[model samples]
Target: MTILLYDLVGRDTARPFSPHCWKAAMALAHKGLDISTVPTRFLEVPTVEGGVSKLVPVIRDGEKVVADSFAIALYLDEAYPERPTLFSGDGGKAMARFIERWSQLTIHPYVTTAAIMDLHAMQDEANAAYFRQNREQRFGKRLEEVMAARDAGLGAFRASLEPLRSTLAYQPFIGGQSPLFADYIVFGALQWARIASPFRLLDDSDVVAQWFERCLDLHDGLGRKVAAAAAAAA
Candidate 1:
């Protein structure tokens, strides 16, 4: 059966910009599962799954409803045990949880500031206002104010990527020979930036850059299918 994925989308429905959503999307692709994606906006999230879920990346497999990106990934892994594994083994599964947390707590903050403007510009008025209000409340400043110093945040962002860069310098993928769910966790964050903003998060020479490119080429150029919007153009 084709699973129903309520994916978070932007003004352009084709663009699914949520990092969490990307993790689930890529995980599904990795498992070679057939998915029917519904492009869902922020305001519409509450209506998903009969209003039981207030988040995107909610998936319905038959009568079973799963919410949260990570939960969905775990569900996919268990639901399709015969397919390719999202986590290689128990250790990888536990490690993936740590990596996911680090990406969310450490990396997302920097990305938020850098891509805030580009994200807002791409949104319609309602989404733009909703995003601005929530984000501003969290950051205690305006969206423009947060993104205005993106250049200033570049150093920190690059520094935040050091662990990934160092690791990729020696290995082809985070899981050594192949990308596991852990790899998708990190890739999703970068993909989030790519879809929402043109701000270059990695330097041209960084190994992380090369790793990210390899990730983009995965699953028949699925990542390349989305057009990246330039942050300056907004």
Candidate 2:
């Protein structure tokens, strides 16, 4: 059965570098799994008839509809056990869960906020159109209200980054040498944020930046591909 991944075109989600979807995509790519990507815009209702709420990064493996990124990762793990293991052992499993949760609960908001602010700055017309359409589809409220909420959300996001900064300062990866789900989760969020906002989150931190580069190298040379493509386009 072919693995079908529902993704966003040009990374339109809250974070431009969606670590959640990236984690799933990276896992599949790392395993060299035969997969097809179906890019969709944010909040676009899925054509599949199911009970799932509207969300991007849904995976369809034959008749099965796997929603949510973490759930999709679990499904991939179960379906293809021969690939590099995500959870090495009980301790590793625990760390994986913690990292996933931390990325979602803490890192996601600030990164997303930064991205939105960046978009507004760089592409005001396109960003405003996107914001209007997305707010109407997802929030079903006036644009003003959505903007207000986004402001509050950004503040909350800044507060959330404090713990992550402290934690990352100590360890090279979330686990140490080898990166597990934690490293990927954090990387994904930060990657998306950097792509969208071009922020300096890792600029001053040598260890974290090096670790991030190492992770990219391990995962099929994504950074290389990006650089090559940019150079070619230039």
- lDDT winner among the candidates? 1
lDDT of candidate 2 over 1-234, digit per residue (tens): 578877554443332334566777766665567777775554343553353646667778888888777677677777778886666666876668887887777876555544555534333355457656764577566544444545456545655665655666777667665666566677777666555554444444445566668777865685344421111123
How displaced is residue 127 in candidate 2, in Å? 8.4
Q: What lDDT score goes with residue 192 in model 2?
A: 63
- Residue ranges of candidate 2 with Cα displaced over 4 Å: 11-16, 43-45, 48-51, 119-172, 223-234
lDDT of 1 by residue, 101-187 (tens): 988987788888888888887788899889889889998998888888789878978888788888887889998898888888888
Q: Compute each candidate's TM-score over C-alphas.
A: 0.96, 0.71
- Listed per model in order, the count of residue pairs whose N, CA or C atoms clash below 3 Å is 0, 1
Alpha-carbon runs more than 4 Å astray in model 1: 231-234
Query: What is the C-alpha local distance difference test score of candidate 2?
Result: 0.61
Residue 143's lDDT within candidate 1 is 86
Residue 2, candidate 1: how far off, in angstroms? 0.7
